[model samples]
Target: MKPLIVKLGGSVITNKRRRFTVKRATLTRLARELSVAKGPLVIVHGGGSFGHPVASKYGIAEGYKSKDQLMGLSLTHRAMERLNSYVIEALQKASLPAIAVQPSACAVVSGGRIQSMELTPIQKMLALGLIPVLYGDAVPDLSKGMSILSGDQLVVQLARELGGKRVILGVDVDGVYTVNPKTNKNAELIQEISLSNWPSVEKRLTGVVEGRDVTGGIANKMRELLALAERGVEAEIVNAAKPNILKRAILGEVGLGTRVVAR
Candidate 1:
């Protein structure tokens, strides 16, 4: 079996309502869930409160335009690193050997996107029975001078370059819903999404999400994740906060969450 590319959604792991807070109990639960994955697991976590707020304040996602963005770059990277440290520590406490792979150090960015990645460090980390924990980060961009690469986008890049057939996103919500579940009591969960229903699904997926998310939320993720499926990588969006949803998804258990079809 290929390595499972698992993304721990920021909202699920971080207490975004507060500044720089990590839900330790939530992460501990997640670590337990991820422990059951049958194949080698590559863990990528969102920056959560640690990343989004600073990036938003600095406009890091807008691509570099001024020297002033440099301070923001350092601040944003440091914030993300702080979050990564918490995640790694929690996983380690769960007896999962994990090491942090700082994205900015190893990934080459251009035009505010990952232009190239040096995979030897990551490949070697997995080979050593240590799971490499990566997160959304700021990196040098040729076109913009600097850009914030989101965990969502990093999932695709890692899966593509590192050889993963299954991509999983563990979010706070059960799965994709017709409306933002937080705001609408009448929101409906859609079980399976493919090209067949995406046109209609896309229309119903609109709503403003509350958070400091620099990377676009679920709606934006759907498109990139679907494109990943089109390349023969099957993806799932599950409620990672719920017990065993992540484990079940990794184990290929159906009826748990929304599955992005592999076409």
Candidate 2:
């Protein structure tokens, strides 16, 4: 089996509005689920409410040049670090032998896109059977100077580099749906999505699906993931709160989630 890249959403880990109050019990369950997984696994998480608000306050939404923006960016990164530490601690408690490998410390950016990802240390960790946990962070960029790289984006890079055969995003929602399940009782979970139909599916999605999704919400994530699918990587979006979903996917069992695939 190829490597599995798991992206845990901050929203699923904490209250959507508060990132510091780590949901210990939920993550404790998640860590336990991942601990028993087989072969190499790479875990990545979002900043949730922790980094976004602070980064917005500093006006670092895109790029930062001003001192105020820089200050805010610093706080934003610290917030990510805070959340990262909590996740790392949880994994350790579960005896997963996880390591916090900060993306900013190694990645160099050009323009607004990722120019390259070193991933050497992560590769070494996987080789040693150690899980590498990465988080969304503010990183250096040549075009805009420093920019925030969402964990979702990092998952794409890592998947490509590691030749990840499976990519699972654990989000608040049960799966991608035709309508906001919170409001529409008739809303149905989309079982499979192709690259050709992603845009239309994305446009129809609403509620809780917004810019804040570190995994880029339904649309952007589908776009990014479909591209990866074309390269032979399989990706899915499922409810992270349900620990069984992760295990089922790893076990190659038919699951209740959205599978993004090539056209």
Candidate 3:
């Protein structure tokens, strides 16, 4: 069976408002939920408080411009690694054979877009019944010295390359909203997003929420997932902050979140 690509959004896994804070209880619970999965899985995670701040401070996403940014690149990659370690620990505590796959060491990008990535290790890990955990990290860019690779973009790449049939995005919200639900009382949940209605939905999405996300936030996520949808890989954005939702979403339960489809 093709592996399912699961993304643990930075906002859901960590306290994005605070720097470097991991929601331990939430992480542990989610790990336990993931342990119930019975098929091949590739887990990708966002940087949240861990990586975004450091990268933003150095303008790392704008690409390499000076020697001054060298430290930021190192620091950004280190921050992501630190976060990845926490995820690895949680997965292992749940008795899942999870291994960290450093995207910085394996991926190369051009203009902040993935040009190529080493996938053999991930492929082998699945064959061995192991889950490969990847995260957003600083990577070498052909045009710029380096750039930030978002987990959203990584999900699309992995799903396309690995022949994944489904992608589950675990975010803090219930799903895509007509507006930023956190700040708007009138915002309604969008149950489904398709190519035909995407143009209209795109207009309703607000800019990045009050956070240091350099990955273009929800707007970027929608764009990337839409591209994947065009390729026939269905994706769902669900509220992972709530208990059991992520587990059900991963288990193929529908209607709990906004479904993004080609049609």
Best by lDDT: 3
Q: Model 2 off-target regions past 4 Å?
A: 183-186, 199-203, 206-217
Expressed as tens digits, the lDDT of each residue in 171-207 for candidate 3 is 8888888777787898889899889999998888773
Candidate 3 positional error at 110, Å: 0.9
Candidate 3: global Cα-lDDT? 0.88
The sequence of per-residue lDDT tens digits that candidate 2 reaches over residues 153-231 is 8899989988997898888778778877767888878888887787677777674432354224566667788999999
Best by TM-score: 3
lDDT of model 2, residue 59 = 56
lDDT tens digits, residue span 112-207, model 1? 678888999888888778898899998888788888888888899888777787898888888888877888898888888887788888888764
Query: What C-alpha lDDT, on a 0 to 100 scale, does residue 95 get in candidate 1?
Result: 93
Task: List clash counts for every candidate, in order.
Answer: 0, 1, 0
TM-scores of all predicted structures = 0.94, 0.91, 0.96
Model 1 Cα shift for residue 192 (angstroms): 1.2
Of 1 and 3, the candidate ranking higher by lDDT: 3
Weakest 10 consecutive residues of candidate 3 by summed lDDT = 204-213
Candidates, ranked, lDDT: 3, 1, 2
